[model samples]
Target: MKHTGFRIAVIGAGAIGQTFAESLLQGSIGEIAFMDLREKPDFLSDERYGRLTSIHELVAWRPNVVVECAGHNAVTTIVPSVLREGFDVVLSSVGALANPKIRTALCSSAVAGGSQLVPIAGAVGGIDALSAAARSGLTEVMYTGRKPPRAWSGTAAAQEVNLDTLTSQKVIFAGTAQEAALKYPANANVAAAIAIHGLGFEKTRVTLIADPAIRLNCHEIYAKSRSGELRVNMSNEPSPGNPRTSWLAALSLQQTVLNKVLGAQWAA
Candidate 1:
């Protein structure tokens, strides 16, 4: 690596960003700049990093790598500029890539700057094999995401069923990845990631289930191609502080940063 202690910038000082900053410091990353709208948390006040409230300053910082813990709005507003400035970007909000226009623009920026825009697996896995299956000719890709009804309160699932008093499992949404991303923005990242990797967003099948019986967030990836078939199921605990984010999503950011700085091998 050209930079021994990689200089990095973290967007969104929320749960995921704070976790990544702590991991980067413990890892080989020399100095990290944490950016967010609010002050650093009581637990995260340290001297090895910088803090900022504006996403606009990222262009001037010119970090070696930028890890995005922020949501889709940050992806649309901040990521493109970072990519245009020839910096690598690791994104946790994979669902935002469902917007083909943003995907197109980001791809163009990465190509023009000769940088890479990497999407973290977040709460789901098997993207490495799914992408390979796509190249080998994919046949079927099934993505099933099951979260408690409370988790789906803000999504369309609430309107379809009584999330508060659901006696059994209920299907909130069943359609393509595009529809899932559009209807369920919170769960879109994982669903959209599967779609973009296996088949284009329009072709990837998605089923979102809200089950009252399950307390943990669960995700399943079933993919088949000419080469073979792969299935993996993951259950993640919700972030203690932020109920909306899964624990693994934050860990994905940490692991990705570790791999970049400490040369740790990470799954794609």
Candidate 2:
């Protein structure tokens, strides 16, 4: 139970990152440091953890693992260097991996530094089954995401559907996972996760729905493979401070961190 030497660094002090940090604080993990554009020196400071402002300072902290709850820019700018430094990473921006260039660079960095890049399951489920089915040859994987109409604001869905006047469920996008990620970056993590676990981005089907009747974010995945058929549906509450993110997504990241640091004996 002595996790005294486990060093965990969190990139980004945003809703998801802070949620993960607070959860980690409640556990036995030792020495948590946060790196963000803006500094909060007093944030989460305790006997075991502190905060760092610059990436240079974070590098000096020498973390065993780094969890990226930052956005896509962090994935491109911060992740590669951490991986190249031989530190494992847990990424919240799984959608960013869909980019060919970034994916290639991350994979190369992980190999070069002998590090592992772990992507959390986010707001979905059945990833274990999907991964197992993938080995036996998955024929199809489909994801349908539904959230309140206001949640579709600022995305391409705004242009396609009039979210203001929408009273019922509307299909804003029906395309491949790649297209979904390109058009709706904010809501692409679940789709990207399904694609990664089951099929490649181009082969996995994706659908984005805006429903006025729904309060929480909902995800439904249907997959068919040589082994069997699977369907998973999740209704996740929005994070308290950030409605754009599901609370379960933050909890999933915490669980991933605990599992990695504590070995296979820890289960969430």
Candidate 3:
């Protein structure tokens, strides 16, 4: 693919960010830049790529779209500001919006700048069907997230279940998507995405499990609506650079960016 003179700015130098950037570069899609506090990596040493230090610098670079791959804090603190600057933001940390205040801020900021805040369907599918079903009135939406014991480390799940010695699956949490996202921000972004597409956070049921037998991150969604009933199951490999993140999440972000640059309509 030839470079289209389109530019994309990514926020974060972490696993997902680097993966998405490398994919864009390999595809020869467009110019790319990184807005991160950390020093630039050697892979981005080419003159065409940029390492920016602040949102002001990002705005000056004039990227056509900004992708946020950073964690929840960045979504709350940085994404709204970027949107307020009239930049369409592709959000990977959808779990952050589980907080009503943060969600409201993002919405208001996007409206203020006449921009859109788009959330990628991370690590899972059937979002389009769910969204359509929602329009016809959804009665139930349930999400079950299962991952290896090691992947649940450092989160509240560690306190709920013994991740080290567990020989079988253990139910760590059962609650609404809002509570699940807030409690397990790093692991429950898919739950939040499903909630946003199928049902509101309060109505979406979420269950998180830590399994010793599964090496992959697994997601199961069951929804019922006036239109029909939907069920989806996905087992995704962990990102090589980060066990806590699904590799498919990075690819989803790259696809979202490509769709934006190519002016392709993406299913919500």
Best TM-score among the predictions, by candidate number = 3
Instruction: Report the C-alpha lDDT of model 1 over 99-218, residue by residue, as the tens digit.
Output: 889899899989988889988878887888788878989988889998888888676776778888889998888899988886776676888888878887898899988888988999
Q: Report, for every candidate in turn, its global Cα lDDT versus the true structure.
A: 0.80, 0.86, 0.90
Could you report the Cα RMSD, in angstroms, for every candidate shown? 3.4, 2.7, 2.5
Question: lDDT tens digits, residues 42-99, model 3?
Answer: 6567676788899889989988899999899999889989999999999999999899
TM-score, candidate number 2: 0.92
Candidate scoring better on lDDT of 2 and 3: 3
lDDT, residue 49, candidate 1: 69
The per-candidate count of clashes, in order, stands at 1, 0, 0
* Reference-based TM-score, model 1: 0.88
Give the clashing pairs for model 3. Answer: none
TM-score of each: 0.88, 0.92, 0.95
Which model, 1 or 3, shows the larger lDDT?
3
List where candidate 1 sits over 4 angstroms from the true fold.
Answer: 1-4, 37-48, 53-56, 263-268
